[model samples]
Target: MPSGLYRCIYYSKNRIDGGRTRIASEIESILAAARRNNPPLLVTGALVFNRGLFAQVLEGPCPSVEKVFEKILRDPRHGDVQVLGFEAARERMFSNWSMAFLGQSREDQNLFGHIGPQTGFSTERIEGDRLLDIVRNLAFEEEARAA
Candidate 1:
């Protein structure tokens, strides 16, 4: 019954701007806000942050996803907001979480290894199929952890 599925990946500057503590708190605040807001909009997503870089995929109603992403673009805590992917999806890849976060967890490291190092927010090196595979893997891993 959903209208559309919107997904996006982006990276931003964190270390040069706020360092570890600041970024940690920022992530917490992001999760808090998402928990409070995403359900209302039926938004769900997965995020991975490492070494001052962030790669996130948001899925849900097109309007809600775009609105949330616009807010992210305007947020001052992060800079160099470069979007890696933006397109319509057939279904939600992360339906369980309003915002599922993957920090430097073992699973995260594994994923990074598989996807290879992504410099900046550039998606030039990551194939679309591979990106979706990574997202799917992270989604399942996160869900298992929650269980």
Candidate 2:
């Protein structure tokens, strides 16, 4: 890992209003922008959206990660954005992906379900490192599936 490498994990309430199709479109647009912007900055991450909430991990040079996260904070599509963690990291977990999206497949649903069983998915209830591990695993699984 480089000297300034860092990882950030956050979860936000989904504020994009519309039917499923519109929401899907918005999420796709987000991914498109991320894919376009991340490579130049050497940022890599995974994003998971479960209709009501969005959880994501970003790993890269510290300045680059901070820049991306600042944009995310200002984006209108996200509300009540809560950063779970932001700290120096020793390694890159999503190195193979600039931005990997975990969708609504059965496997993804099961992954999300395991997070919060009784009270549902609550950012307040989950720790940053745990979320990072989950997203990292999902991204690797996705990569394998694609391969």
Candidate 3:
């Protein structure tokens, strides 16, 4: 029997509450953690941080995705966690990324108009499907740019 596949997209505040001038350190720490933790559980995903918000897609075995998401919720660095999308996916959109981080570069900011300077994970400003599309497109776009 094949395992069930699941995809979850969520948005959260992008502050490391009380941390000082170490956002880069904090983000690297999170990525390192994901790299170490995700593979064992067969989880694959990408994370985006733009306009002071975090939007991420977690896709893999249903249970594994849930487990990692729950960990994300418990982490104190993130706030205002909201699930944008959660459903069964036909396949992984970010199979190559354990946790790819998309920064607030000019290019990244231009990927979606909704992620402007003032935007911060508002459901009213971005729908679930659009959020998924943005992340998926970001993954591919970034890859193409890299290549």
Candidate 4:
């Protein structure tokens, strides 16, 4: 692990209410807030939403990552927040992004299906490392597509 860097991986039940428009707006609001708040704190992460669930990876200085996660725990848009992993990290996987949003594409759905097969996409049984790998892969794929 690096000097003061840490990583947090977690999943939460999505609590945003409304139709597609409302949900889309709420997600935008989340990305907007993360972009605004994380730069100063040197936090970078990726968020994936699928089947009414959210899986995310946060990386940064220990205190900054914890601060950001505390805010996440209090956010009403998320519930049943479960920390899959929180430990010192050697490096950030999403270093270039303040907060990357990985949209739910067919490929993503298939990936999630494989990860959470027993309970219809529930992240409860998934390991932190596995979830982290999935998020990292999706983020990288998104980056590549953009490039």
Candidate 5:
């Protein structure tokens, strides 16, 4: 049921109270390399400034995903960016998106159809409850901090 060759959960946290400028700098650095890779990447989920971490799901071809992570791991801005946890996804949560760039927002601005109700992620074999649980938990933490 899975693409097998590719799937990864990008779990990372910045130094506590790194602030938006710090986070943005990190993102910009990653994007610089991501743009070069020219790979199909969908940022299905994100936990920005959540519990002092910047976590997300980056799904695509295995090579591209690995390359992205390698770049991130090597980036100076990714100070203390730790890979917390993850699993092999059955399919892609954000399949439709060729590339997904995200920031902290709650308005459900889904670039890929997979993120919103239109794609029906459950039908695609993704565990909807689990996915949402992670997002919600992180959102609660991030929103509280932002507030």
Candidate 6:
């Protein structure tokens, strides 16, 4: 019997620069696969750094998603990837998203800061920003970096 799959979305922040971008480079291939019409386990996510903080959102199967996240945190650039608030979705939120997302904000750092700690990192590592603003800024910065 196959285990059930889930869609999990959470964000984390770290006190570092270029870390998110470097992670981005590493995930370029995975991201491309995620952008496909449909992929197995449907894993996709991103990480974005701003003001000495790196924020990210990941979505996919529970086990596979967790595995990918573990690999990301071990990347030396990531630290304390605390869960902001993840839901076991009936399906994918962004059919176009996979692995990890970069440059997004926590939106409610205070709320996220209350979720306790995971992997020795506290919710205190959260960032405050509007979701739209974070995504937009991240898109711009990523483009500039590529140029």
Best TM-score among the predictions, by candidate number? 4
Query: Deviation in angstroms for 8 in model 6?
Result: 3.6
Name every residue pair that clashes in candidate 2: none
Write candidate 1's Cα lDDT for 83-106 as tens digits.
767888778777778888875465
Error of 5 at 74 (Å): 1.4
- Global lDDT of each model? 0.71, 0.84, 0.78, 0.86, 0.49, 0.49
TM-score of each prediction: 0.78, 0.89, 0.84, 0.91, 0.51, 0.48
lDDT of 3 at 57: 88
- For candidate 5, write residues 1-147 as lDDT tens digits: 556445455444455346667666766655555555544443333333333444455655566677666766775543654443344566665443333444345424332234437444323433434444555555455556769
Model 4, range 39-143, lDDT digits (tens) per residue? 999999998887678888999999999999999999999899989899999988898899988965542365577656764448377788888888888887887
Model 1 ranges off by over 4 Å: 1-3, 15-19, 107-114, 117-124
Q: Using lDDT, give the best candidate's number.
A: 4
Error of 3 at 122 (Å): 3.2
TM-score of 1: 0.78
How displaced is residue 121 in candidate 5, in Å? 25
Please write out the lDDT profile of model 2 over residues 1-147, one tens digit for every residue: 469999999999889998888888998899999999999999999898884789999999999999999999999998888888999999988887888888556423646677787435573777787777777777767777889
Query: For model 5, what is the error of residue 147's alpha carbon versus the real structure, in angstroms, after optimal superposition?
Result: 25
Over the stretch 27-67, how does candidate 6's per-residue lDDT look in tens digits?
A: 46445644552246467555454444455555567876776
Provide the lDDT at 135 for model 3: 79
Residue 100 of model 1 has an lDDT of 83
lDDT of 4 at 93: 89
Estimate, for each residue in 19-85, the C-alpha lDDT of model 3 and write its tens digit: 4347767888999999999999888998887556788889889999999999999998889888878
Candidate 2 local Cα displacement, residue 77, angstroms: 0.6
Q: What is the lDDT ranking, best to worst?
A: 4, 2, 3, 1, 5, 6
What range of 10 consecutive residues in model 6 has the weakest lDDT sum? 112-121
